[model samples]
Target: MKKPTLRLRLLRSFLVILTPLVLFLYYENYYAIKIVREEVSQSTSNVLSIHITQIDRTLDEITHYLLQQIVTSDTKSAYLDMASLPETNGNYTLAKIKIHNELTSGSTAFENFHSFFAYSVKKEDFIFSRSSFTDTNDLKEMLGEYVREKVKGQSFSDWIVLRYWEKSYLVRVAQASDGVYIGAVLLLEDLIRPLRGLDYGDRWEAILLDTTGQPLTKSVMSPETMTAVNRKLVTNPLAFQVFENPADHKDYLLVSTDFKQAPLRLAAMIPEKSLLQRLPFFQGVIYLIPLGVIVIFIFYSHYLRKMLFSPMNSLIMGMRRVVKGDMEIGLKEAETEELNFLITTFNHMVSQISHLKINVYEEMLKAQQSEFKHLQAQINPHFYLNSLNIINSLSTLGENDLIKKMTEHLADYFRFITRSHRDTITIDEEVRHIRNYLEIQMLRFPEKITYNIDLPEPFSRTMILPLMIQPFVENAVIHGMEEGSKPFHIEISAGNCQEDPNCLEILIRDNGVGFTPEVLSTFNQKKFGDGTGTHMGIWNVYRRMRMAFGYQAEVTFLLGEPNGAIVRLTIPAIGAFHEMEEEEDGKADDR
Candidate 1:
């Protein structure tokens, strides 16, 4: 079996030691940090709730005081009477003076009162308090614009906080019984007085936000810090949340609580550094543990690389050489038993592979030789049987002159076949053999058989396996002859094929009885029948050609013109002696 790779071994070792250590450290740190954050958030939330409640109560008092001033004032009835009278009436002037005195008295009665205005919708006139900073025209325009734009068309009275002259104010708008709009404005700083009095730490900041989440009091923070806080409020409004500030890359806990009596949110922001500083053990040991763990991991990794990775790198190099066909390579034994086992196994595998390759090569040669001898044996009996049959027919006729000529041709044909122990012969030699056999057949048939040989000189020297073409010629002569001497004509021709110039095409055709439908289908389907005469001859030729040239050889049978058979043989045009010489040269180089 193959041994585990060095990387796998090192990973196993590291996981056994490092996994639990890392998990323990992570859990411990997470639990401790979680406890600290929860305690801090809870404490901060409680304090911020108290401050928010105080601010809510203070605003409630302001709302009650504004409502009382509007309800108890006698100026409300006098202002309605003045708006009902004409501009020229003497009582209108006296009543307007009385209303202005009441407004001035109400504005000064409250602390941090900015201004108060009473608008008569029917008369298009505004009455201002003495404490108003702007002129009556500006106050009238401001009040008219506020009613038209901010209040829209609603007539209900409600308290709202707004910014005027770059300062926040708590404003209450009420419609008096006389159909006049009365507005009272107080500075927002006064409403948040209780929150300001609370003792938040130096690192903590308190803010009062209006209903729209805008800071009501003046902000002491930089623009970037305020922007970060505002972005957090957008996602988690009216809730306690913690986030990291982009400006300083430090964590801050934001505790936000909504005012129960007003549309306002109070927030307290405290830096996490200050909160963690209050913890007993977070300062010293929290940093040292991770640093020590990192140091240990570094030393452990270095030791593993020295003992494991270095040896594996050598083994990898040896494996690459083996892949490149150098099976003789072997790695030296490593210090560990597992590594030594891998090296020893690799060496033994290479040795066995070398032996198997040699055995496979020798077996391939033996199989080829055995097949060649078998094909050679198959050729002789078939040819000899036909020759003997011809001789027997001649003797029965008692035709000595014709028999003498047939015997000479038969001797010449067998002499050529026996002379060559090699598998291949030149096309010219094969054609000569076919001519000898045809001459013998012509003697037997006399004037009934006529033959023609057409061979191009260029294709005469092309190599082909022995006994390839003679079988087809023999078949045509024997089975294709007609009765009553109807002139059986056999034509043998060879040339280089036009489509593939490297290949030779030899055609043997006869002008005699053509193949029947059944026989033609058998040949076309390449299914040879099991018989001793013509069937075995054609099958032997087809098998030998395929074995010798592989895909380069083709044997086809067809009907010739004027009702006869055509046999075509296509094989590669390689010279016999030249191929033999090349093979000898390759063998010498190998040695």
Candidate 2:
């Protein structure tokens, strides 16, 4: 065989190179398109994931808030009042105060809430009102069926009709007390408004539903789609499920998240089309640049190998030397002086970061000390007041039933303060604390003032702050009634509020004197002008409640029936809070 010529050899070599280059171009395009598609898919998924997360978060927030209110006895009383309920309408006086506080403290969402009410177990009436939304009749009938099916301790949500407005609301209900259902109603507009504010496009509308798939908002959704989604949720109510979008016949992602240790369910959805939109754009860009298409590739390769590659190797070695505590390592000067400066800067940055860490540690210690001092200061006044009350009792009257009750009240009050373990407690404990304090006052003026306790049964353990009821009672006994010839009657009662939850109704009436508008105005002031000795307890109670439970807990004074003044203490209740209720029952049995 004849040997091939040099020209033929060069042609053969070129053909060998060309074949691989052609194959590389084709494979690069194919893989580039595939990567772009995957990236687009991932991006869309992430966007939808965020949207769904937000929706879920909103539902959680609404459910958390409503559940908190319904579980409370005060709010429960207010709800019963709203539906024209008479069971505890007298106790609904405090509902306004609780609602005002809730709005002020940002616990509730809507500003112009009309009422809160619940349906009775018999479904004969719908009890509700504008604030602390509660109901009796509707709640009784509708929730009766739910309690029998759902766990006794569990909470659930649904859409409820409001009488004052044309809209509906997302109402969450729980068993607050026997024969009484506590619930909170959030305007549907408010719940979905935040979602509408979200940048989710028209193709991505959120739908809030009960476990049975009933629409909680007025958002227009196809009936068939709603039914299908509800069926799917009912089948596996606790899990997340994604399905084809019924409106556009496109794939959509759906997910559900159960709020940990909270009575809330969140679900979200994202369309698949949104994710794949950018795939083509990325595909075009990746294929437009080919590494081997340049004529200067071989020349550039030489420079990279000779100058860039060797210098980078030395730089990396310098880094290793520095890592090994050899910071004095020197580098050969290169055309890129910036690289040398970068290495020097890295060493300096490490030193600065170390110094910053030490400074931060010292600052943290100082901050912790300051916080400790502040905490001590906060507790001092309360401690002093408690000590003073104790001394006053022991010195004046030793070891009597009245003193015993007073001491117990003081102890219970302090116990609540020390237990600063929780933001709220059962209404029952709070009421008992209130009654104990009143009993002490009764001992002081045994024949002067008459006290009556009229709380509904089983309202003891509904969640409330311990001293929430005492401040109002103190205000009534100390300020509203005078020591004169006329007798002073202080009535304390817990009843179901028509539209809110349970309300602790307290009316302190005196024939001696009634309060004028000036006294009322002065009392409403956030800070009492003369803190020297006046309104300290009242002010402390007011400020602490605002801080602890937000504006939802407050002390209010009004003209009382048959003369004197009526001071109402309204607090939020937890439906599941039965601890105080049982304790109250035990107290009654003892009596």
Candidate 3:
């Protein structure tokens, strides 16, 4: 599967986390508003109910007192009903005093009770009890000018909204025995004045509504708003009202309760905005949560892309160039600390790899130069001249068979020398080349030179460096030859070493003059034993062995047991051509 980019991954994770947070904030806002609305409405309703109950109780008391004044303990007609009293009836003045005394005591009995009036419609007589907050002049003027005519036309016996001296009053009227009316007047403003100081909120209206949802007194709201509220209260009839006021384009909540003793409802109406104004600070936080999240998301995505995704994209691009072998590429330093560290490490790695390639190339050049030297050293023109001399002598003697044999051996020696440029030659072919070289020597020395070669048939396929054995053989012939009576003998044998089976052990024994101690020491030190540089070739072969088969490829020059020199050699196993085949495979991989 294809992988997602770093930006996509980080954004996906950010959304996964942010989605829940937004949802949670939205839910919290909804829940908080829901709870606050309920509590506010319920609390307003409860407060309204308390005030309404108290006002209802006061109205009940005034109503009962008015009814009591119209009847005696014996259920006879009351004083206000005596409209046609006789001139000799002294009870008339006493009755007026008694009525005034009863009205006075009743007016001061409870809060906002202004007057208790007893009026005789037949006699056109009126009486009132005045309190400190009441204006008796307004009442006397109302009695003389308005109440006399207003009561004469009012048909219902209930609470009436009456005006006196530009102020409204709640007048409760009760008829007693014939045309006598007993009534109580309450200052409408003072009756429900305490409700205005309620701790509901700023800019609320306290209203006393009749059963028909009509306002009985002045209120903060316009008549238009009141009409709409009254319509909802009458039609839908909820415990609370949710009304939008058209006059001010505001929403309001109306919490009201009915008065048990009167046809009125005491309501507290507050604007929706004002209602929430008193809410705790968390309510405002609930509204701001979504806005805060939006701001955070915008900045979060920007920084994440800038600090993380952009740098990661650069790093990925740099890696692609590196993979495609662009070692010259480089990345800019990142502002973020962790990404900067990664970029620095990548640059160092690329530098180290470039340096390693250079070192490897130099090593390969050295190996090729060494091989060229080996090729040059193998071509000995003097050996060819000597072989030609032997053949010429044989031909002069007219020995046709000996001349043919010498010419064939010399030709084989020249052929092997021409092919010395090859890195490796088969063990069997090398041994054959050695036989040709020895045969040429035997032809020159006749019976004075003799040699034997011993190599197992299974070891014939073992590959070794070209000219590896020939230089040592030439050393034995060149340095060990002596002018002696005994025929010079040389033997070459190879087998597995007793020390390590993974190695090859070879012994070359020659019954000829061996090396001196000085020559042996100089050869071990990789120096020419003679001033003529003859031993350098042997050292080159030894160095090549060490290169091909490591330091374990040992060559030791020892004095022979009785007369000759012994050349003991140990090398990494040449039992098969496995090592050469592996090297060729490695070269193929490089290509």
Q: lDDT of each model, Cα atoms only? A: 0.74, 0.55, 0.73
Quick one: ranking by lDDT, best first?
1, 3, 2
Expressed as tens digits, the lDDT of each residue in 421-512 for candidate 2 is 34455656666666666666666776777777766666644565445566566656656676566667777676555557544333334443
* Candidate with the greatest lDDT versus the true structure: 1
Off by over 4 Å in 2: 1-422, 499-512, 525-533, 549-554, 572-591
Backbone-clash count (model 1): 0
In order of appearance, the predictions have TM-scores of 0.57, 0.31, 0.51
**Whole-model alpha-carbon lDDT for candidate 2:** 0.55
Model 1's alpha-carbon lDDT is 0.74
Candidate with best TM-score: 1
Look at candidate 3 and give me any clashing residue pairs.
Answer: none
Residue-pair clashes, model 2: 73
